[model samples]
Target: MSNDKIKEDLPAILERYRDRIEATIKPYLSLNLTPDENLTWWQSKFAGREKSPGGFPYLPKGFDYPQTSDGEYLLLLAQINFAEVPYLEGFPTRGILQFYIADNDSYGFSNYYCELNYPQSNWRVIYFPEPDLNAENLITDFDFLPEKYWFETTELEITKCSAIRWTKKYAPICLEDDSAYKLLLPQIGEAVPFELEDLYEEFTDAYLKILDNDGWFCPLQMGGYSCYFSDDPRVGFSEEEDPFDTLLLKISLIESGSLFFYIQSSALAKCDFSKVLYAMA
Candidate 1:
């Protein structure tokens, strides 16, 4: 198959099979997960159970008590040994779907971790705190557009070679070319005029230190900038550092943006502040 065709077919196949996979696993776990809530809900449930002194005793059939490691534990449940799971009908290979659950409650420890692996080809890992609200409701409430979902098209203006045109048109500047900009504009626009004043009061010392270090414009440019692993000759990765750690940090930033946009979009869509605050602490 062509690469493009494979790319197109893969997501469709994954989406089609995702529900069947969740359905098979859900009956064997303590949590009830909707299609949208599957990853986060399962991660939270497993993490909570793993961290507790006694693991969750209420798991359904075919699941075993998780095995504890050095400040972590992993639970391996049912596998797709055959075409028994309805979704595996046409897939060439049918093998294990391992569920790894882990947690650590100590300071600076990773609070939660969950992984769903399909042999070697595809794997997904999620980490987060326990859900304060219903898993389904939390997923629904936080359904904001992903960060990479943006419109990018360049428009060229042409005029007669020797002629100058002075047609007046106004277009608002967009900070991020994504749907969140549209949803956040009303509030952020209102706050823009007062942003400098607010910053002066809220971050006087840090702002001054930034000015001293990198000058006035640096603070504005720094907001959109992110540190990412570079394979480019300049600022390349080091032998000592882990590439996976860099990727995880990058994913964490994306998740942070998604959560922030969801919360700021509406009071109703806001995540439970206590859980977030406690997690940070």
Candidate 2:
């Protein structure tokens, strides 16, 4: 409300991703979505309807096209409208963005885009992609979302420091002091290093040992780095930029480590996590 559009960088960032988003959508609208061995899958779904003359079949009617405007993408990915979908009773949609996200680049996407449900510190993806054909949602949604599932806290980094939550305008950054929201590194299911299904037992111990050496004494919250957001109305808002060069969010229009109020999630399930994950990945 003070000067030039605080979110000015958003447009440039979206343009950077525009081509990739467009490229990703090509297959979803055609037979390419079905494997050669399952031609029947495509035939059955489309039935007798022919693809559009442009060679691109749009998503089924009633489905929401992705929000492609510059800043719109930011709001779609980072902000949420709580009035839309009810939170799963135990997993509150609001929480700090912890950093324990699984970094598996072999797949070109994080294992999870996690947020710790406030007060409880339980982790989960609010908008699990509701895949039902028709692209479900936009490639941008898939491009922006973190992995889905809940990671309960095993410890907490209870620090006396004031609660911290930094929001970015068009970037995937926000910090939830590892002290409060909790972050659990991949030891088992959610994110197995090298996709090694057998490392959980040995890795979790080694991981914890490292934390202990770092002065970690939490009895419950645990995990690697994560992003956080504040639900506190008293929390002030700014328009700095996002910290960390997240592969997917690296094109952020926001500066690095700048905290603002715009990144808060209202806990809306308006996205299709499963589809986006599959496509974006």
- TM-score of structure candidate 1: 0.19
For candidate 1, write residues 1-281 as lDDT tens digits. 12112112223323433333222211100111111112322221211111221112123234333344442233321121112222211221232222232222221114312221222111212112222334333333211211111111112111101111111111111222222222323334434456556533333343223212211111111011122122111122224222111101011111211101011112212222111101110
Off by over 4 Å in 2: 1-60, 70-281
lDDT of 1: 0.21
Q: Candidate 2 residues 1-281, lDDT tens each?
A: 11111222324323443333222210000011111222211111111112111111123345443322222211111212222223322222432121111222211122322221222111112232222344443232223433322121122211111111222112111222221211222123334557654444443343333222211111111112223232322122122132211111111111221111112221212222211111110
Strongest candidate by lDDT: 2
Q: Ten-residue segment with the worst summed lDDT in candidate 1?
A: 256-265
**lDDT of candidate model 2 versus the reference:** 0.22
Off by over 4 Å in 1: 1-66, 70-92, 103-281
191: Cα error in model 1, Å: 35
